[model samples]
Target: MPNATTVTEVGQFLKNPPEGFTVEAFGSEYRVHCSEENLVFIDNFRSGDCDIVFQNSLGRKLKMHNLWEYTRMRKSLLSKRIYVLVSLCDQNIPESSKKEPSEPKVLQKYVLSIDGGNPRIKWQMERGLDWTISSVAGESYRVEIDLSEILESLAAAGVIAENLMKCNPIWKDSSFSLKYYSDALFDFPHWFGFSKRSFKLRLIKNT
Candidate 1:
């Protein structure tokens, strides 16, 4: 059993989770437990698999799973006054390849934001300055884009690229924070083609 205040705190923490905090799935629900604070309990219970017994510092315990109930719970929390903040971490492409390839490979990188509750992209980079097109006719041209390759690289790095492709505007208007690339971007060799970039998004509150 999680109270409204506790649930709101949990959501806030998830928005900008502190270092060392971890999330794990327990049975059919998700649990965010912090060993440092000795807190552990289910946060979402919509699967109706609630035969669990978990406790936390707040002194609330639960053992049931109902999707509708969970939805109501989340709505109850969202109905309260809250602030949302979106943050983007710095991304840097390494100059040296981990392995050599027979042919030259063009590698592009991207930083994107996905919905924590769903598979959607709140924001992402559309194209790089290097992107170009070759005109073939008066009204026709061959568009050359590296977005696909860049997305593939991000996916390989464990990002949810498929969901990011949806390009949802749900997060529009939300305050955003970013960590700009530091001097590390120029430390690599010039031929390595190192590039630095940023991504943006906005989040809105129900209230």
Candidate 2:
């Protein structure tokens, strides 16, 4: 029978990622990267397992053609050291979803890699950013990222949001997770701030 892993064990491994690495693990989940110096920690509260988490101040670039182009610029500026953390839940995918399921004891995880559906790969390669991947797995896997390169890519894309601009924030608690989302859909303009630009909008009453 296949072995089962817990979040606590995963946390232990990430507590110390390595010299050029930073790690975090807890609740049967963890993330590690020696070259990128990045780690992720997650605890599953649901009935099933949680996948990886890709944590970064810069979220997805709004207008990129693909993930590759986005990754290229990100690696170039972040000194070729990038950290991407992802977390997953065991939600049901309907039969119409066109995705496959893992067997009873297996799970599939796709990290923030060039081929992992990065929307900008081709454009990035044309821009001259060189990147290679290395994968390691034990109780878990260690994926490498070049931070400098990633930062640079964000700047070039002009999609890096100011609020999440920090390279990495000081997380106060030993076991905590960060999540991002918008209350409204893409087309609906929600009230995020009351800045000058937003205040100029006109309000009208219908008859």
Candidate 3:
């Protein structure tokens, strides 16, 4: 498992991505220019499980199913800087896994990373949003969101929606019964201001 230090290191890397490095959000890949001698490519694949694949300009390829294995194997070949970059790129694995289980455990979390500068933004927005779902055994699902960062993002983006700034908004204590939607397909859209940009959610039930 990755610890806080690892997560923090990754966050710092993103705050100031190194030169000649670029991240592809759609494919979840990182391209790094190691040096004139070597170039590194990191790609993430999601099947039933998550996997990380690394390749170099020299045509060498390495794949690891988990971070522990990847860290250990690449220690010799990768420098401290390169290692941190790779580790940060792999941090998304745990985030993606948070939604894997059919039933919510004690608490399940989902993180949304927003681009404040996305040309589509019409107002202020949140850059990082954390959505948490809590359930007790088989009881109703309780959903809550951490909105501080979102408010800041919105303000930064010049979004002027007053409703978004109200205290303890509806999202704070929203509840839903798992049994009600157990058989039907449902979609929920979280709209940001008047912009057509929204997060569309599709519910999937396990049989």
TM-scores, one per candidate: 0.19, 0.24, 0.19
How many clashes does the backbone of model 2 have?
52
- What are the per-model numbers of colliding residue pairs? 7, 52, 6
What are the candidates' C-alpha RMSDs? 20.8, 20.5, 20.2
| Candidate 1 backbone collisions, by pair | 46-67, 48-65, 50-64, 50-65, 171-202, 174-202, 174-203
Q: 2 or 3, which is superior by TM-score?
A: 2
106-147: candidate 2 lDDT, tens digit per residue: 121212222211224333432322322111110111112222
Give lDDT per model, in order: 0.28, 0.29, 0.26
Prediction 1 TM-score vs. true: 0.19
On residues 142-187, what C-alpha lDDT tens digit does candidate 1 reach at each position?
Answer: 1211123322333444443334434321211122221112223333
lDDT of 1 at 59: 19
**Candidate whose lDDT is highest:** 2
lDDT-based ranking: 2, 1, 3
